[model samples]
Target: MLNIEKTFDQITAMGPVHLKIFTYIMQMLRDKYDVSMIDFDIEKSIFFYGIDSLKIIEIHSALEARLNCKIPTEAFFQANTFKGMIDDIVKSISNDGNLGIETSHYSLETEIQEALDYLLRDRPQRDEGYQTELTHTTLLTGASGFVGTFFLKELLENTDLKIFCLVRAADEAAGLERIRKTERKYNAHLPQGWEDRVQIVIGDMSKKRLGLTDEVYQEYAKTIDSVYHVAAVDNFYLPYNIIKKTNVVGTVEVADFALEGKIKPFYHVSSCAVSLLEQCSDPPTIIGLVNGYAQTKYVTEQIILRIAEKGLPWSSFRLGYLYTLGISDVDLDPNVSFKKLLQLVAKAYDKVEDDFFIEADAFENFLMAIPEIGCVPDLDANFDLMPVEYGAKAIIKTSLLPMSELKSCYTFYNPCPLDWSDIVNYFKQSNKRIEKVPLNTFVDKYAEYVRHTDDNSIKLLKSVVSSQLDQQLNTMFRQIDTDMVKEDIHWCPPCEKQFTHAYVDFVLND
Candidate 1:
């Protein structure tokens, strides 16, 4: 039989540094989640143990303090597996004689290109066995996410198909509970007897075959009629290598599943950020992008396009910022730059008397901060905000179109987007204390204001401030070309009409 203690003893024999790092990780797992090191799979994602982005941040901070050296946050994220993370920690420790930045020979662009080439090879052919329409069953990934909850709602309410929700959980009961939690959180209405129409398939997208067994995987591959892949790690700060396993590799796996069964129509939810990158670069270099989230999304879209070329009926919906329909605080992506900025602004304004920043309504903090600071950053960008409900419905309706009429790409963004000045104007009318200032001026003011408080929130505020100063981020929300999408899908509802105070109250009041 296998002995975990013996293996751990062997590890401890390597070196004191290795022993310390390994011990901390093992202890953290045990103390926090009641998980033992032996039960942890070295090859699986750290998220498998319920480590979220916030937890990763906390872990990195503690490791940095213990090791007495700087560790890149991206390094932790880039480590897709537990073993990869431990290895990276050791390498960081070993090279800390000078305590300088760690350099690597890895190239992100080359990695993207190679992964794409590998996926394109031996493309699946459409035989006579292919089904022409989505009739009976469909497979949906990211059914528990913000926009995904809406996707689940749309499919259940509008279609007669049974859905196989690919969720990461310990078992079927756990997966179903996860979906129920999402439905409650997002206020998604589930029809009576809805459980009969939905099946929870416990799986991880970051793994091969989506962490499914051979028999079960093959069964779903043969039975599922279509695919909706919306699940992704949306952290903006993590680098490409870290997010590649889920965003890029998971996409490839989903495509593989789609092609394996009777050829299915693959509806991919892409990002408008890709369009922003393309417009900014004469010829975009994947490595030159500002964040890993955009890089992985770019690569995933290319993969979908290649699959479309190989006879799979695929459609990509390039969505912008997906806002809440009513403001129950469920549609927002926590990692999105816009939400982070709002939170930081809120913290800066709500400098509490304690050692930590008190949590307050982010929208309220943002609105209040403008008047106190007397200036808003002249971002000079239009927000292509789309309501979650509309985006979800649009994806479903467009995907259900006749295969021959299906366009390879459809852009979903506000046809009439609101400029930064528009939002400021609403607040200015209520409180004349605010005015538009240059970006640099706003950053300096924000930083100086945040410097007054020596707390944990200060670090996050500084990071967000520094990110705002990045030149690329300023252009991240450029006008997305939606003429083709509008013309192709004539019956599709408009994404948004105009930026109004009523709309402001709808989002900020809660």
Candidate 2:
């Protein structure tokens, strides 16, 4: 068990700045999370375990306000320990005296550089005679996820190649059950006799060799004809270090495995968020990204680019927001972004007090608070609502392109995007009217609403609103460039109103 008093006493010899940083973070943790460390490592991050990413943002804001200094968001995300984070915060605020130990000195750029070096340290030389066509088998990761579920359905229905799904599970049966669960969630079905075509390989991307034994790893490396990597931590608010093991390092593991035997064509499923920094110079800097998910994807794409430069046949499919899998009906994940937004509206209109809310600083209070306050911010943003089926089909179509003709990257964003005003209008048609107000007015209204509320959900909501007003600004997504996908794949999103209407109707009723 970790002793809080003893740890503070040890740090007391350090300067006041160190003490202030430590005290602020500890107080914020206790107040927001109601956490008192019982058996945690003092040498580990204050965000060790059970601490949500939103809590990190809260601590970040409180430390900034207390110290009256701007600490880099990277400092919090990159630090390995609570002590090191305090040390960095102290250095940021003060220059006099021995300002504790300066740990995590590298920027996001340096971290990405070092990670790239390590992942590509002992790169294997590619073998000759790469198969341009589908062979006997393909290895797929994230087969149980939203887009991957449709990818699995596509392969099983269309191709003669056997699919080896690399799933993280206790065994083959559990892995199969997870796949079945995803299928049921999407109301998607596999072709008859699908068991004969799909094999489950119990493995984890976070581990070396995908958590496979040496013999099994080598066997798959030699036999698998292609690689389709779709797995990721997929959280926008999490720090880079928290998701690094799975998103970045796991990608490297997959890349290494692809290069081990007869070189396989790697089809990496990246996010359109990589477009956030697409305009950067040859090697994009990680500072331009808003969150860790984008940062990790940016780094992974850089790694894949380097590998592609090394003559590994690779194609990256940068996907937009997969709104739903079965577009015809109400087959959607409850946690999908647009659904959450609609849910907030429904909660607001009905005066429903739901205990469960997706806790993230990026989303925080605004979505739900909109209805409570009876006003919406002029968010001036649009969403690239790509159906999961379209994304899956696009990936498959491009992956099958002749090796010589395939572009290095194919970005899949919806040609017909949904604007914020369109969504507001949709709700109006459904008989829920919300006033569209300026950003400041919305903030003012939210503040007034917070003053009168003492509910648990409102407490969490106020933690963000009262701490930082700028967090209330909508997270604007820039238009993604999909020229490669447009020219090569010749695909467009199904613009039928049925898709949007079904999505809206489903959330409203739920």
Candidate 3:
């Protein structure tokens, strides 16, 4: 016989206050959704049976209201089991206890705001009375990229800057429509009259001077304050000449344009790959790679630095592996390294070799043979793992820094210091039934599995699995350095228990 009281008692033993909050949530669900064990096993239905993701958001809001705690956004994925959810709620209580944030006295908004203030202690104070007039109308290349989209969101949230996006199409109306769609997709609730805050300019980075007409260039010069150059060809396997033309020469054009316009501060997005292959004498490695992508980025960085020296207040941001919700669509282009590896693995799997072990062996050899293999050093390398949102926040915050405070031509903001080992451990723990294998071994096995599975749908499944692994790995790595960013910015903490509970409930339902 199931002892409901005893189950509740076990939860209460973990923490009395958290138990109260859980009781409140359960009661609310029962009343609102008519959810009950008899009705459909509430836990199993919500967690394992695969409730809508939007419903999870609703639950998050409900729990916050009941507990008077600001559950971190990351907690949604972390607390995927029933017990795990309760444990997370208890942990929230513990953290709040230290802050003297009593649920009985303080409103949820007040508590959330206080937490935000503490997290963003190092951020520049907002000047409410300062004239909202943006002296510079900035154009963001790759305005559709993950970093670009988040950057736009961060700007909207934190600053009064006017943004213009460079679009590939020459037609102004078509570009504006595309920008609108992007805005609606990311954030539907645009500030009243937000369209007035943005403009879409037709330009192509591949062409000379961004292919802008003289009249358009003059108008840009007169109105734009600076340009955030984020567009680049990232195909690692592409010919050196092709990469050089787009990444290197294209950057030279952008720099020249910025210089010609006398834009006060030009921002360039470089990759951490630029800091590869070269052995550094210090405790941590800082030197970059010899590969085409890294080498081109290094050259671009030098060009931007030279531009800064020649009177333009230019800043180069060396970003690391970027992870976000829509990353599969934005970051993982078909030509990128990860996608290429997946394709290779998929093709190898299709051959139907005699033994899985043989297939795995071949895949392992292929991964190892890749050039410029460098491990992410110092589990806390700031740029090693960064969430798209946090990365955007860092970029916007740094951009807003006063000219006097901006000392370096190149500034490195490591978004998060998450450990890959933590991610590997997490996967191992999550799928305990699956035998733990070394990364190389796992990759081999995965490749072999893909090869042997005859179903056509397996290709999509493999892609999804790879993307999830990338996301989890990136999250773990960012967690290593999140303390600094958390201290300096408003980022939701990981709600490990809630996500775990959710996962458990989901599995049970399935």
Candidate 4:
């Protein structure tokens, strides 16, 4: 093969010019990653299995800088292999120092179409053994996650079924301990004698078949009467490939696993971001989504719809930011939830606007976490909060319904979204220190502030909020009817002003 695994020096056969270009490319890759550890096969694409546009851009810039020459943007995408890149570089310099591709040919739409191709490739077939049955033993992924732990407690307390929790751990014992710790975090103690009924399947969703052996995978698949595929790589800013592996590929593997043996209800815990694709769609296409997390959800949901057409029963719960554990010793370690984020901000604040209800330190943290939310000058946004404790119950109840009764999309958003006006007033009423900070103004200004801010907390908060909340606020949306959600939107309380201060105090004390 022209492209083989070798160090930069091993390519002595190449002309001195080709050798220089190859060395710079390899060096640029090593700058950020341990190239020795990277399974680099020149025969393979610079992007296949690893690498992305960002790294490609980095390499392109480095090559240009080293060669003191310009490279067309399309060359990066076109030169998919090591040899191709070398050939392109040679051709560009030889052919009147110009390449023949335009930047307009490659766009976000093109990239998304490529991703969709990867997501839907090699569709798994329904095994002959596939047979639908009532719930007896359930296979659940993400059992150690924030909402997953609450879900574990719910299943343990409510059902006689044996629960197989697919957790990523070194061993079964380690996985059990992790589950125990998660349960304790939420104060949801494991039930006595529950050890016999709960089996921990140590595995990674980022791997094929949940990183289990075929025998083990198929064995569990045969016994599973229901599958709660809650596991996901939830980072809003993760590179598209990294998140896609878990959220999209892992989902397909789990769904295929469901189709492999004893069939049952497939309940996927997705995010409300899937709707964002449509919200921002100029012509209403899934490609409208920009972030990796939301794009994965949209792709996975589309896959599920296709799977459902084949009579594989499934239901998806498009959840919003969930707040579980109420106010008692409120859980915040996950820090992924919006409520937990507010809790972090609460610590940075000192006092309430009323000048009595909240401490200054608490108020300070709140402002820091949401520096702008603490002093929102405008009131034109909506905050959706679904308490996890109740939300998990709703999932269990809804998933248990007959497949014939389920809808394709079951969004669990607050029926009455808390108005940004009421939210600002709530914080204002709590602390006079808080000022009116317009969300639009705050977002525009803070976008720059976040760039220069050295605080990791602020940076992380910015990354999460910018991708999810910023787009959400800009998009025109209404509280969608939850008639098909199987649970009343009214069943879940909104993020109200009445409990605003109390919530902060509870989070602070915890």
Each candidate structure's TM-score, on Cα atoms with residue i matched to residue i, is: 0.69, 0.73, 0.50, 0.66
lDDT (0-100) at residue 196 of candidate 4? 87
Q: Report the lDDT tens digits of candidate 3 across residue range 104-195.
A: 12132332334334322432322222212336467677765545766666666666768888778758788766655554444322345656
Per-model tally of clashing residue pairs:
1, 0, 43, 29
What are the clashing pairs of model 1? 78-242
Model 4 Cα shift for residue 346 (angstroms):
14
Evaluated against the true structure, the overall lDDT of model 4 is 0.61
| TM accuracy, model 2 | 0.73
Query: Which candidate tops lDDT?
Result: 1
Q: Candidate 2: minimum summed lDDT over ten consecutive residues — where? A: 467-476
Highest TM-score against the true fold, candidate: 2
User: Which of candidates 2 and 3 reaches a greater TM-score?
Assistant: 2
Give one digit per residue, the lDDT tens place, for model 4 in 117-177: 5543563544453435455789888888777877776688768888999888888899988
Off by over 4 Å in 2: 11-41, 47-76, 86-127, 280-289, 325-369, 424-433, 439-509
lDDT of 2 by residue, 1-510 (tens): 257766777678776767767777777777778877554455877656566666665566566556655555556655677787777666655655243222222254565667667655654544556656787999999998766888888787668888999999899999998988777656555666777888999999888999999999988888889989988887654556678889988998888787776778899988766756454443333332344576678778877876677676887878766654343223334334554444543444343223322132223233545566776666565656665766877788778878888878777777666565655555556545678766567656665665455433443343233222322122323454553344322233333364466555544445
lDDT values, one for every candidate: 0.66, 0.65, 0.50, 0.61
